[model samples]
Target: MIELGKYAGTVLAAYGVSLALLAGLVWQSIVANARARRDLERQEKNG
Candidate 1:
């Protein structure tokens, strides 16, 4: 593993928060994309 010295806690916390935010962003993007695809399919079928 990597050592972070005296600032390890602060550094690790920052990384944890960043990782969580990124994960949430990715999840939202996937959901939104899927919804858009479904809407497009419905419109195409009705048109």
Candidate 2:
């Protein structure tokens, strides 16, 4: 890697936090999609 020198720790921590937040958002979206699909199916079946 290039010489981040004194700022290396801070830079790496920021990257880690950004990646974690992105992963959480993706996971939440997938779960919400599945729940919505199930609800739709149930409603159709009862109609």
Q: For residues 1-47, could you state the per-residue lDDT of candidate 1 as single tens digits?
A: 69999999999999999999999999999999999999999999999
lDDT per residue, candidate 2, 1-47, as tens digits?
Answer: 88999999999999999999999999999999999999999999999
- Badly placed stretches (over 4 Å) of model 2 are none
lDDT of each: 0.99, 0.98
Give the C-alpha miss distance for residue 9 in model 1, angstroms. Answer: 1.0
In model 2, how large is the Cα lDDT of residue 14? 99
Model 1 per-residue lDDT at 1: 64
TM-score attained by model 1:
0.87
lDDT at residue 11 of model 2 (Cα atoms): 97
Clashes of 2: 0
Q: Pick the candidate with the highest TM-score.
A: 2
